[model samples]
Target: MKLRETLEAQEFEPYIHITRGPGDGGHWARQYAHRFDLVLISGGDGTICEVINGLSGTDKPIAIFPSGTENLFAREMGVLPDCDQLIQTLKWGRRVVMDMGQVNHRKFLLLSGVGFDAHVLLELNKFRTGNITHLTYFWPIWRTLWEYRFPPMTVEADGEIIVENARGLMFVSNISRYAVGLRICEQARYDDGLLDICFYHCTHQFRLVKHAWNTVMRTHCRDSMVTYRQAKKIRVTSTEPIPFETDGDPVGNLPAEFSVIPQAVRVILPP
Candidate 1:
């Protein structure tokens, strides 16, 4: 209501549609996909994922208003907190073509993780109730560290074939940062027409601790155990079924094919 009022007061023409239940965002997005010039999403990562899924292949751009606990994608674009400022900025903002990642047919704006990270989200969903909070992920993160077992997977990217035999996490990002401001893929650029892939090949507690420290210091990519690469396409296959999460939502199990849609979607960003 506040956002709507602010936009209306600014004399900016905006359309508002509310969803009734889960997965209703996709339906609402499709309904307005052709009618709007740009779609302003005012919700969490899950909602943004739904909107992207709906607007895939369309030329219309998207502007985001971060209203969720973890607005990972919005944070990357540097969106402001004030709704009025956001509206004013959008008036003069340029639409930049940014890369989007696809797992099978689903689209993701931020990052996707296979193995460890996916297991964490899977566990988190089991305990999530109405209105999720940041604290809601604490237990799951802790449990994932202690009890989670990693699966070995073969990763093929940039003409390099590597088999990771330990319990580890793989991050395929269009943007540099992941959750908690981790620069796992430090050299990544959103509009680079390529995907940055990071693989952590250590499962030992001490090594994981060291990797986490390096991640905090933004030097994780330099670690010998961590392999970083850029590619237009990546294919991962595992002997056991490994679940994967895209833009914070669990999509499906591997073998997963990740590819970059170069300069595919337009987004309103700061000048």
Candidate 2:
């Protein structure tokens, strides 16, 4: 059955809004947010991130319908945009408060990456024409890994210098799992009031390929070249310039600060 039929059968007054382009997530939510008790967004992580940023100062709870290319956040939350499951969540699910990460004033609910992954996102955004799939990443990743220069960066976690002049990849995670089912930061907790930071201290292409395989196997956290920590605040700077991405949307070049807004957004989950 259709979503409207399902919701109507469940006795709910559901509101539907479709986005026209990038950056419309916030607009749609802001324009119609006051008319509803709960806002259910149907998009991938990037679209959800835009909505989160728009809903930063509001009190209404948000739910996801998972309708984009890489639904990383939905995958992490075990949410699928099926009528049965959505109805179940809307009718019987509990509302749990989840933490959102802030980097230079922007909010992200999933994870953020600096260096290689960010470069891939930067390249991917150039060709994103509202349709993206797994195959769309192949060429971008290949080109970035081979041609992108590794910039040295300095990282401070909780006021201590953990990395200085290092050429590696950094992942600040609010969720344990990443894109394509990779658990890069297994220690991440959405309610723990901290961000999980993982550093892959390898710049060579072959080593990164090995690291990718290890991440797929969920063993990257234990590798000797990897450093993992939990912190409420982190500051990152680079000698040149470092690209960064939050929830798969390329944000900007870094000299960035990352911190968590503890228990800010309430999310409805399957009971």
Candidate 3:
């Protein structure tokens, strides 16, 4: 109600949309995006991904309102909705073009993960409910750490082999921050026209934990088991389908290919 009144006062007609379920935001955006100059999306990372994918291949600009569980992308951009900063940005913000990652046919604005992280997401989605909080992730992480059988796969970037027969975890990041503000791919740039890849080749849970700790410390890039680099395209091939996550949403299994769409979307951001 407040947002509607505020927009009305500003002489902007805002259409309030309540998503019916997953994919609704993107559906609505795709249906109505042709009529709007800028679209404001309110939700967590997953919802953001939904809307981003909805607006893919278009020049429409989007403003994010962080109202979801893990507003990681919002924090990365240093804009939290419902604050004076967000209001100021809405009224007077600079437009920047940001790269987006595409996994198969789906698009993602943040990062995408395969193997262990994807498994965690698959489990996590089973219980995702109202007002998702950090606590919603604890059980999934714990269970995935113990039970996930890291499957073997081959990773190639730009048609060159990066890893072969690897059974660890891989992430393709367009933005720097993962959930909890972990700098999993610290050197990533959203507008760089390239995606950053982080591959950890240790399947042991203890070593994985150590690498995660190093990520928390922002030193994982230097670890021996970790491989970090930039790529325009990455192809992951597995003997069987491997689960993958895009911006924290559990996307389908891989034999997946990922590539960047350079400056795919115009986004309003704080200066």
Best by TM-score: 2
RMSD of 2: 1.4
lDDT of 2 by residue, 1-271 (tens): 3766778887888777777887888887777787899988887787888887777778888878898877878887889878788988887887889899999988898889999999998888788775888999998999998987678888899998888888889999999988877889899989999999999888789889899999998898889888899999999999787999988878899899999999988889876
| lDDT-better candidate, 1 vs 2 | 2
Query: Which stretches of candidate 3 lie above 4 Å from their native place?
Result: none
Better of 2 and 3 by TM-score: 2
Better of 2 and 3 by lDDT: 2
Candidate-wise lDDT, in order: 0.83, 0.87, 0.85
In model 2, which range of ten residues has the least summed lDDT?
A: 1-10
- The digit string of per-residue lDDT tens for model 3 on 1-271 reads 7777777777778878888987798999889887987898887888888888888878889998888766888888887776556667778998898888888988888999998988987887788776667888899999989997778889999998989988788889998888887989899999999999999988788988898899998889988888888999899989977888888777788888899999888889875
Off by over 4 Å in 1: 164-167
The candidate 1 region of ten consecutive residues with least summed lDDT is: 158-167
Model 1 per-residue lDDT tens digits across residues 1-271: 8988898888878888876767798888876778877788888878987887788878888888888876778877788667765876678886789888888878888889998789889999898888878788889989888876677888989567855554577899999878777778888888998999898886655677788899998888778888889998899888898899998888899988889988877788765
| Candidates ranked, most accurate by TM-score first | 2, 1, 3
Q: Cα lDDT for residue 74, model 3?
A: 88
| lDDT for model 3 | 0.85
lDDT order of candidates, best first?
2, 3, 1
**Against the correct fold, how does model 1 do in TM-score?**
0.94
